[model samples]
Structures are given as C-alpha cells and as structure tokens.
Target: MTADTPAPEGVRLQKALANAGVASRRVVEQYIVEGRIRVNGTTVTELGTRIDPENDLIDVDGTAVQLDVSKRYVMLNKPTGVVSTMRDENGRPDLRRFTKDWDERLYNVGRLDAETSGLLILTNDGDLAHVLAHPSFGVTKVYIARVSGTVTAQTIATLTRGIELEDGPIAADKARLLDASRGESLVELTLHSGRNRIVRRMMAAVGHPVTELVRRQFGPLHLGTLPAGKARELTKIERGALLTLARQDSQASPGPEEHSMQENE
Candidate 1:
C-alpha cells in the first residue's frame, strides 16, 4: 500500500503485537521487516498489514502468539532489599520471587530503589502502563521518609521551592514534617517527578539524609496494610478508578505546582 493509503480493516499488525505484550509497536514493526513475524504461516513485512486477531494464526519467531485478553493488574507491597525488576542479574532478590504465583508475565510500572519500599503496581496492560508511567499524565506518588537530621521548616520550604540536583531542578508538590525527634524526623513527601532515586537524593540535598523511605501511595492506590512481599489483584472498583484516571485528558502544561497531588488518607 502507498504511504498515503489508509490502513485496511482489522487492527494494524504492530498494534496487535503490542497489545499481545510482545513488544512496543515500533519494535514490532522492525520485527516484521526482519521477517520475524508471520501471519497465517506467511511472513508479513508490510507496515500497513492488517489482520483480524481473532482469525489470524500469528507467530513470532516460530512460536504461536496467543493474545492474552485477560489483562492482569496487581498491587505488591514491595519489601526493602528486593529489587523492582523481573530478573536480577546478580541473583539477588527481585520481583520474580514475590510474583512467582502469577502465571502471566508482569512487570513493575516504575521502580523503587532496593533500599526503599512500599506500594508498587505490576501489570501486563501495556497501554495502562504507558499512560501511568508517562510524565504527561502527572501521576502522583507519596513517600514517607525517616531522616537523620532535624527536618526543619526551612528544609521543607527548600524542598517546596525546588532544589537543584545533579540531574536538574526538582521540587516536591508537597512536603510536610510528619513527626520529629531529637536528631531525626519523619517527613511525608508528595511529588509527580519520577527521577531516579529522587526522594533519597532530595532529602540528602537538604542535609536530612533519608534513613528509611516508603512509598505510601501511587495515584489512587495505597499500600494500606498489605504486608511486604505480598501481592493482590486490584478490586473491581479500584481498577475502574485507575482506568478513569488514566483516561482523563492531561492538562496542556502540567507544571509541578499546577496539578493537585494530595496525600492518600
């Protein structure tokens, strides 16, 4: 088909591959050109190729591709010292150990550092994952931190005003001193920034090193009382709410201060 031609009936081949969790649409197109994908026992190399997923005999690298229509969404109370990855190359504790009971391939939405722990979502729904992970959606995450220094009001102010990090300037949507001790304190932080090790680095930058960190909430999902290393499928109501949030039209420009990132309970 010509470049200007509209796609034929049924879904595009790459979209089918991505929805089946094989890979992203762009990567799947490459696989088609490389003759790694076959539809009804015939190699499909055209970018405009379309197939009825229900009727097509699709295969990838000689393996039959059975689309998993039953998308699974799981919430895991991640424990400290456990990596948020499907596999750990060093043979260290990873998400696989906790998700051993699940038969479907699941991956964490984002990540929490090995030293940090709390609510984490694992799912095979690539569209939902992409929506939630993308910064444009502005999904807020709340973290509670135990710091080694007296978390003064000035520290909280600094965090709110924005601090220059090694990567760039980042500010928390909200920062509050949960509790304070003689030399240490508990601070609750809320932000939509998904920068690497941001909470730890931000606290350290403000001279209050994070001794312990736990993500209290992600978007509408909360850790609640789920024990560490335990997994549970999202309830029907919870799942519906999450999808609604993901589908909402994001603002034209979602600056850190513009969106409301409230604490969950």
Candidate 2:
C-alpha cells in the first residue's frame, strides 16, 4: 500500500494492462506482440515475462504507464435492451453511448449481457477491471432471473448441487425456488466462471430457460437505487477497496514481469 512496500509478486503484464484501462488482456497481448509495449524504456514482446506492476516502469506508445490511480470508477444501473459491450459494428447502442455526457474515456469493468439488466460497472481504471474480472479471484455474481416454467425444489437443488453445461461442470454457490409455482421463480446463482452466456446456459441445462435476467450484485459491490440508465462514481472507500483487492490478489498470484499504468479522470 506504500512505496516502501515491495512490488506485488507475479503481476502478469496483461493483467497490468487491464488494470491500467488501456485494453483487455487479449488485446493488450496483441499490442505487446506488435512491439507496442515497453518496460523501462525497452520494447517488450514476450508474453510469458512478468514485472512488478506497482514498482515497474511500463511504456505504451512512448507514454509511461502506471496504475490508473485517479481514474473514475462508476456504477451504472444498466437498463434492459441496452448492450453492455463497448462497441458493436452491428449499429447497436453500446455502453460508450451512455457516457457521452461524461468526459472521461471509460470501459465496462466486467459485463451484463444485452438481454440482461442491472448493476454494470464502467471505469477508466484498468487494474480495477483486471482484478475484478479475473476468474482467479473467484468473484461471486448474484443474478435474479425469471424463467418460463416453475422451478421445482429439485431443480434448485440441481443448480446448487452443480450441473453440466456445454462448457463443462458448473455450480452456483446458492439457489432457491422463491416462487416455484405459477411458472415464475426467482433464481439466484453465484459462481466464478466468466464464460459467455454461462448463467443462461447453466439454467437451460436444468430445464429452466431464463425469461428475464438481471445482475443484482457483484462481489462486495451492490446495485442499490441508482435507477435504470443512471451512473454514479464510486466512493473513495469503494475505490480504495478495489485497489486493495487488486494488491491482495497480485500478491497471491504475483507474476514475473507485470505491467502497470496511470490514468486521469
């Protein structure tokens, strides 16, 4: 937490890029391979190499990189029908469209699918995004889903007990048939898997096709009453917690030549 403290161990370069808000890990890796990333005034192309994020020097496109310390962290009450993606060449409204009123260049932290609604995080801080999105942290997401058919207690048990999806075996930390009758049930699931359409796939595998889905919570973050289509910056405490979480995880899984960055809101 202080300069005197040693740099985080096992900090992956891509992880630092994500934490910097420059781009996703995949995209950043491509940039690295293309010779766009430099560590301490040297071009870096090796993906396997790691560096200390907090203590190392990372340069992208001739610009020095550091943690996005002042980047704006926001909570958006995403409305249904609005996609959470950054860009869609198909001409659909993406998350960036919602930020036209704000000056900061931002990216969605994790995601809420096009059909899903509720708490969506948008931020310029790349490390926060990286730490939050990384599956290694075992981030728990809570979703409230409405299904077409009544979900029996056995179905809930199956979800909680774990089921096999097309990807592989998956399990929700908890589940309940809040309203098993009338073909309307509130199903809650928590898992670390971040595969696309994971929750929907898991439910469909259990004979409970989702009719409507909304993300209610993500880890220590909440949706509260921000209202549909509204965004609010994270509090100082929230931002600090995010950084602390990243530091903790980085320490736990410290890489050899991790990357880092800085941002202005």
Locate the minimum summed-lDDT window of 10 residues in model 2.
Answer: 256-265
lDDT of 2: 0.72
Q: Each model's TM-score?
A: 0.69, 0.68
lDDT, candidate 1, equals: 0.80
lDDT of 2 by residue, 1-265 (tens): 8989986566788888788776899999998999998876679999976887656767676555545455687888888877767788887878876787668888987777777888777888776688777666556678888887878888888888888765577778887666666756778776656667777888889877888888878766788877888888877555555555555565576333211111000
Winner by TM-score: 1
Error of 2 at 21 (Å): 23
RMSD to the hidden true structure, all candidates? 12.6, 13.8
CA lDDT of each prediction against the hidden true structure: 0.80, 0.72
Clashes of each: 0, 20
